[model samples]
Target: MDTASPAKWVPHPEGPEIAFFDTETTVPSRKGESYSLLEFGAILVCPKRLVEVFSYSTLIKPADLNAISVTSVRCNGISRESVGSAPTFADVADTVYAILHGRVWAGHNIVRFDCPRIKEAYAEIGRPAPEPKGLIDTLPLLTQRFGRRAGNMKMASLATYFGLGRQSHRSLDDVRMNLEVVKYCATVLFLEASLPDVLSAATPIDELPITRTDTDITTSSNETSVLVAHIEEMKLDSSNAGTAPSYTTVPIIEGSSGFSGYLEPEEVMTQHITVSTLPFGQFAKMAVYHKDVPLHLCCANLNVCFGVSTKFLDNAGRPKLNIVVEIPENLCKVLDKCDEVAHKMSQEAGSISQWRPLVKKDGYVNLPTVRLHIPTVANGDHAIYSTEMYQKESSGNIQKLVFTKVDASELDTLFIPGNMLDAFFDLDVYDYQQNAGIRLVAKRLVLHSK
Candidate 1:
C-alpha cells in the first residue's frame, strides 16, 4: 500500500485529532542495527465522535535498499523493487509532520518501535522529529488493560486472539489492523469494566490448578501440557484483586524528561499492574526454608540463561543457586516500577536489604539479566521438579511427560541460553541467611517451544 488521499485536516483547529499511525521499517539484521524507514501510514481519528476523519499512507525509499534484509521482506513483504521509485521519507516528512504534529499519536508498540524509528529517521536527516501532542503506545496499554491470555503480546497474537486475522504487516494495513484490534479489545474491556463483579464471578475456573495424573516418559507435548497447567494456575491467581499490586501512572518522557502535557485525561488508562504477585502456596518441602504459603509472580515470558551456585552457600557448603534471565527493555521499564513498589512493600515489612533497581538504564537494555534464587531443601537435595510436564495426547487430553524429573543438572540444561520459558514466580526481597536483594523465586516454568 502506497499513497492515499488524506482527509483535509486543520492542525490544532477546534480540537486535536487522534492520530493513529504505524510504520514499516527495515528489520535490523544484527543487534544494535538501525531501522531504516521504509513506509509510514496514519489516520486522524475524531476523539469526541470516535471516527477516522483522514488517512495518509506512503512507501518510503530508503537510502540503501540493502537495509531491507530477507527477514524484513518476509516480515512485511516489502522489497527493493516495490519501493525503488517511491518517495523517500524526506519527500513525505512534511505531510507526515503536518498530519501528526500536535496530534495525539497512537499505535501498536509505537513507544518501543515506531515512535523511536520515526524520531531516528528525522534525526538522521538532521531534522527535528515531529512532536506528538500526546503519546499512546498500545503495547503496554493493552497488555495491562486487555490482559495477556492471548499468549505472546505481539500484534499478530492479539489480532488472532480477537479473530481479526493475520496482521498484514504492511504499513497502512497494519495501521488499520491496529485500530480494529484496539476497538475489539476496548469493547471487551468496557464490558468487563462496566460489570466487574459480574464478569469476575462468571469467569471460569479454567485457570485453576492442574495435577499430573500419569507418569508418561515421552514427548515435548508433555512439557507443553505442564506449561499450560502453569498458565491456567496463573490465570486463577492473577484474578485476585489484592494479589497483584497495581500502580499509578509512571510517566516516562522520551529524549529529555520534559513532560509534553499533551495526554488527555481520558485517553489513557494511566493505572497499570506493576507489582505482580508471588505464587499462592507457601514454601513447600523444597530444600530451602519453605514458606508455607507459596506466592506467585505475574506470569512472564523470561529467558533463563545461566545459574550461579557459589555466591550464597547453604549450611552443607552446597551453593544456594540463582538463575539469570534477560529482561526485554520495554518490559524492564515496567518492572523497574514494580521493583520500586516491591522495595517499598519490603521496607514497610521491616526488611533491611538494599533495594536493587530492575532497569539499570533506559533507552535499550542489552539482554539485561536478573537473578532468580532457587533454594535447596537438603544437602543432597538435587530434586528440582516443575509442575508435571504434559503434552496433548491424540485424544486431546493432557498426557504426562516422558521425563518428569527436573534435577539441578536438568534445570541447568533446561534454563540454558536461548530458552525462553513462561514463568510464574515470587518477587521476593530477602534479608535472611546472608542472602539479600530481590529474588525471582520461580514457582512454575513452562518451556517455550522454539
Candidate 2:
C-alpha cells in the first residue's frame, strides 16, 4: 500500500449516475487465509443516457488446500492448475481501482462484506484502495422499508420485482443485477431521491419494524410471563367482542423518545384498571387519570399496566391501547390505585370535552396552513400533518418555534445550528393542517429554548 497517497474520488452525479460493483472472492475471510479473486465486475449507468459495463476475471495461486476447500472449485469452475501461471494481485489492482474510482459503490450486501474485502485486497497489494464515496446496501434497506415481506430481499427477487431478467453467478451477470438493484432502489425505495440524499440518509444499523409480534430478547423470566398475560388479555377482549376488530400491534422500540399513541377510553368511572405489559428498556412512565384528575402514577424498568385502551386491535385480533406508563426500575409496584383517587380520576375523565384538540401550544402561530421542515429531525411533539403532502414535497421540513425567554446561545443549543440551516428550506404551509378546531396527532417535537 502506498502509505502517502490514497485514491481520492467524488461520487457520481447526485441523481442518476451510479456504479454497480460486485466481486467473487475465493473465501470470505482475510485472517489466516489466502485465496485469489475469481472475478470482479462493475456496471456504470447514467439513467437514460448511457450504460457502461466492465469485468475482469483471472485465476490465482491458492496458498493451500484449505483455500481450495473453502472456495469449492466445483462452484467457481477454477482449478489449482489454472491459477499456477496467473498474474499476481498487484497486476490487476489498478484496473479494478479505475473502474470503481469516483463512483457511488453499490452491491447486494456491499457495506458488510464486499466493501471490507476490497479494502483489504488493496492493502495487501501495496496500493491505496479506491474510495467509494457512498454505498447502497439492498438487504437492510429493503427490510426496513417493507417489513418482513421484504426481509428476504435477495438479488434474484429484487430483480424479478423490477422486471429485470435472470442473473447468472458470473461477474458480468452479477454486475447487471447490481445495476437493477440501484434502479429499483432509486425509483421505488428512495422515491426518486438523489443518490447523495439516499446515501446520506442510509443507516448502518438495522432498524427493525415497530410491531407487537417482535419481542425484545433481553426480558427476564418474570417479565416474559407478564407479556404473555398482556397478550392473553387482548385475546380475551377480542373474543368477547364476537367479531374481530381491525388492529395492528406496534412494537414499543427501545429508546423511543416520546409517546406513540393516546387513549380516550369510553368508561369514565371504571376502577381497578389492570395493565399487563413488558418494558423494552430501562425507563418507562405511566400517568393515570380519571377524566382530568390524576389518580395513579408509577415508574419502572419492567413492563406493567396501570391503564388500557381497547380502541385499536392488532393484526392478530387483539384490542390495543396506548400504554402511557414508563418503566424506571426492575420491580416498582406493578399496581397502583386508591378509592379516593379513582373517584377523582373518574370525575376528571367525565369532565374532559370530547372535542378537545389533541395538541395544544400556548403561542402556536396558525400561519393559515401546514408547512414542511425539510432536512430537520423531528422532536416528537408536532403532528405529522399528512403523509400525502409529505410525499409531494421533494424534501422534508423543519419545525421552528420562537422562545421569548431564551437568548441566541441557548436557542442554538435547543434547535438545529444556524450554520447547517442552508441544507434545509421552509416547506409550503398550505400542505399542512390549518384547521383550529381539528385534533391532530403530534408525531414530532422541536424544543426552542429561547
Clashes of each: 28, 41
Candidate 2, residues 129-176: lDDT per residue as tens digits?
A: 876555555444444443333223556655655456555655556776
Task: Show where candidate 1 strays beyond 4 Å.
Answer: 1-15, 205-450
Q: Considering every candidate listed, which one attains the maximal lDDT? A: 1
Q: In lDDT terms, how accurate is model 1? A: 0.55
**Candidate 1 C-alpha lDDT tens digits along 98-217:** 877766677775654576678778877878877765666665556665665654456787777766667787777777777666665655655576699877424874554333322421
In angstroms, the error of model 2 at 103 is 2.2
| Weakest lDDT window of 10 consecutive positions for candidate 1 | 236-245
